[model samples]
Target: MTADTSVRFREFKMPDVGEGLTEAEILSWYVKPGDTVTDGQVVCEVETAKAAVELPIPYDGVVHELRFGEGTTVDVGTSIITIDVAPGSGPAEEPAAAEPPAASVPTPTAPAEEAEEKPKGRQPVLVGYGVAESSTKRRPRKQAAPSPEQSAAAAIQAEMNGHGAAPAAPQDRTRPLAKPPVRKLAKDLGIDLATVTPTGPDGIITREDVHAAAAPAPAPAAEAVPAPAPAPEAALVTAGARETRVPIKGVRKATAAAMVGSAFTAPHVTEFVTVDVTRTMKLVEELKADKDMAGLRVNPLLLIAKALLVAIRRNPEVNAAWDEAAQEIVLKHYVNLGIAAATPRGLIVPNIKDAQDKTLPELASALGDLVATAREGKTTPAAMQGGTVTITNVGVFGVDTGTPILNPGESAILAVGAIKLQPWVHKGKIKPRQVTTLALSFDHRLVDGELGSKVLADIAAVLEQPKRLITWA
Candidate 1:
């Protein structure tokens, strides 16, 4: 019998995961050159415009090469990995020809049964099946080869050697060199990479180098160039006009398009209600001093988040999506509470799933982790999906109030204004107390004005008197 043979080389490119994202930064590579990979095997981790995503191999084969190294930013449709599918090998193969059709050749159905009954050499495709259609699941820790510290050390060593490492190489670029994470930190802070002086043992860039870069640069010497003779009045002398052009990339670009789209598409109706949050603020102070809540970042937002969860339980209509295709209003029982954070990469709303089930301390920890991940641009795509409702804290920016647009899909969004001490009439007497405004914006189609107003009032009532949360719960 002849040996079945056919070699196919398949190139795997990064796909636009979602949210109209264009480019992504490679976080780590799972398979190295020359390794055998299976279909649906995670090849690398990437950070898109919204969250971190894992890219899987589409076919099983020997990995020919990785096009981009960790920390390199690659555009969509760019080939990231190559696989060689060698013919007639692995667990799959063809069967031997049988004798004259016996009762329809018994319709030889099962591959395993045929293999056992006949002695035919069969070859299967490298990856048994195609890539999984669902989003890649994240392992608790990535299975990539190099540890973060090792990658950092190697990067430093390469930098010291004078020759720059190939941009696609994944060996740690951080050396007595700067680490990739640190380099990322610098980039997010607008620190110039070249100007950051290394401070490590081998003159490698260190965390300190990045921190130093974030510091304000020393003022340049006030060199007095002999002043050019003053231009004559009305002489059409240009005042040394200069225009600076900043390239739109990363966070800035993503935020701009989302804001414009949400603003126009959603019929936004922002209604504000002032609340006396003195009790909520007092609870924050108590939680801050509690020994059990040691590491948690307890703040007014935690209480507000809890209040929102309770209000949502009473008003499920606010937590829903408008499905235009199905022409139905989809209601959700579980809450994925999105917290709108003003990160260096513009504004991002990464949510906490099943937030209603978490205790106050648990909510505090979740908020802390979400903020840290968003700030580092490491929020994963899953975290950004299935958000039922959103909260934007303009108060953080010291602004009293703002009208926020509803997140795409979700029917409602709540904005918390800055909390300040103000003289207000309390129980018929004017007194100084902690006061803030709560603004609720809802989709006129899914959530009516009455429902939106009720939700906003319920949240305010909880903040106005912290004990209401317990009763509602």
Candidate 2:
């Protein structure tokens, strides 16, 4: 057998792991160059904006090259690896044979543009697939005709303004190159893509470029004009060299954007109640020893979650979402209970599907699996979607309570405070009892103050009595 071999490299581009997610950060690689790999073998794990997922190579081949390193964030449709499917099939003396086929390979843009003409079968999924075809076509924006003299004047003005030559006429330049996610982001930030500088590979505008464009530029210092005074000591934090700046991307970035949108877009009203949860705490201990829930997670949170579900059952309207676009209140017949969990990546709310129907032990098991998966960064993007309502247990951190923010698209969120033994008047006697504060934050657009108060009261009532779960539910 000859030691010399010819290489046939097949490039595998990054796929859209989630709906409209433009990019993913390569967390780790499982296969290296020269390693033998079979079809459906996982080659790497990448973290998208939603969740971390393992990507499998769809074809059998030897790993040829890794285009990007670990921790590198790659735009969707960009090639991240190449595999030599026909490794050692040709002799070294026939190296010229490989060159012709390599040269014949079409550019990524051509295949994407012509994909609709191709007879579509079962397209390869995950990592190995190219970009998915858009179902609808967009007509290019009409550009006004410009005279040669006007164009010359514009170019001269652009150069005088230190912007270099004016940008090519709209008809002369191809549409700004950006992926769907980047385009969506630019839209959300109210930025015109043409005005933003492209810093990505091959003149593609990236999320960072959009964000940079969205940020307010510093005012040019002038000797004739006095600078505005700095605001206060609190605002001076940005002036220090000790500050650490973290680039927001992935899950953290998504969370931050979602929270900001939720805060400003939704009218939030929070109702708080301090109640004696002595009975609830006792029930939690009893459930921990129960044979049915022997191995299941039985904590104050489990009971708190059950209580919130009961409250939603009594006030079913509070489980609804406000549809701003449709101008209607969407009443959910089923409840997907989101539990706010702080993970190393960021805060994630992975909900239990159809949680209102689950038994106590079943709900406990579901909660246990959800938490375990989130902590391990294995929660799927689907797991975090379609939540009707949410519960945030700040109590676990020994905090009193918090005005929890409603998760985007959800109507309400319940925040549980620390359970502590405190002196309280019970049966007209001052004695120590387990007490906790519960704060319910809801969107006032759908849930009014009266409805919000009723829900909060019902939750407190459940914890106080600990028997209402059966009666109310």
Candidate 3:
């Protein structure tokens, strides 16, 4: 019996790990061809626009082949790997030789058992992402026979191009091998997919290939007769090496898009206040030594966060989002407090869910976990969503203050500056006091000047007098 008659192959497509994510770049592969894998085993780590996610194989199998290599950005719903489920029955067939020049057109061939058991709706592949409906509905393209004259011309052209013979005309290819997203991209750029050459695995057109096609062709020189001139040693060494170019993707790319959208969409109104945080600093030290907060990460940021929460509680209207589609102000009853942390990948704000209900000790623990996970690059996409308000501390970098932008869909963001012992007015006299500046940027469309001012004032008051946390709450 042949290998195909005994072996069963299953192809795993790239999943949309994050909500509405169209693509992901494979960061690394844990298993390769011929490696035995179990159900729920993580086979590859991929970096989506939101965060890095590990994809787990849904069933036990021996790896048949990996379609794409590491660092390849594959579209969601495109098959990335093939697995041989019944490898023990017989030798697995090599699929590379059977692949067509246009790889986008996949044949709808599945094991009889799989076809019978296939779900009507989407099938779950990864834990959270279900297989797209279109992934399993591929149909073979119908090839039209070429005329005798066309075949003769192709033969002549192939010979003249140094090839002895050719099977089909270059223009005889069926539909261009591109995923739906790639097709849409080409359509948006006004570039025909037929004019682009595919470099993706199995000769499928990629997003890069489309962009390359869309780029304007350089003008041909009218008269090119001059010979090359010798360059100086310094010029030769430094020519075309002035700048370093880095491809923006993953979390950095997401952050950039979000920031741009938030900046432009939201009507920003920033209010600043320099306050004496002497009591807040003292409270932080006391909390660190307290038995209730033992073994927890307690710092000035914790107290600052607590202070901000108390302020929001006092001015509940400030904790809301403007819904453009509905044309309404959506006031949030519960707070998901976002804390901005700078990581190697980029700046990410992972919020604590229902933060308004967490106790001081619980808040400290949550903050600790959030910071630790972010530093290790283990933060998930879910952790970064649904934030009502955000706080960014530039104090760690010894910066005074900055007007922080609001996180998209959120109403306000607070910026905390460095706390330094400076000369200040205390009890009608100049004295060395711990002071810091706070800047609050809010969506002016919903939060008015009075509402924004009250929120900022309340936070400043809480920091100046540590007892107000208990008093205000």
Best by lDDT: 3
Ranking by lDDT: 3, 2, 1
What do the candidate models score in CA lDDT, each in turn?
0.69, 0.75, 0.77
Each candidate's TM vs. the true structure? 0.64, 0.68, 0.71
lDDT of 1 by residue, 350-446 (tens): 8999998899889999999998888766677778888889999999989999888888878889999999999998889999999999999998888
Candidate 2 lDDT tens digits, 30-61:
65444567788888888899888888898787
Tell me the lDDT of candidate 3. 0.77
Return the TM-score for candidate 1, rounded to 2 decimals.
0.64
Give the winner by TM-score: 3
Candidate 3 segments exceeding 4 Å error = 3-7, 95-240
Per-residue lDDT of model 3, residues 243-354, tens digit only: 4345788889999999999999999999999999999888888988999999999999998999999999999999999988989889999999999989766889999999
What TM-score does structure 2 among the candidates reach? 0.68
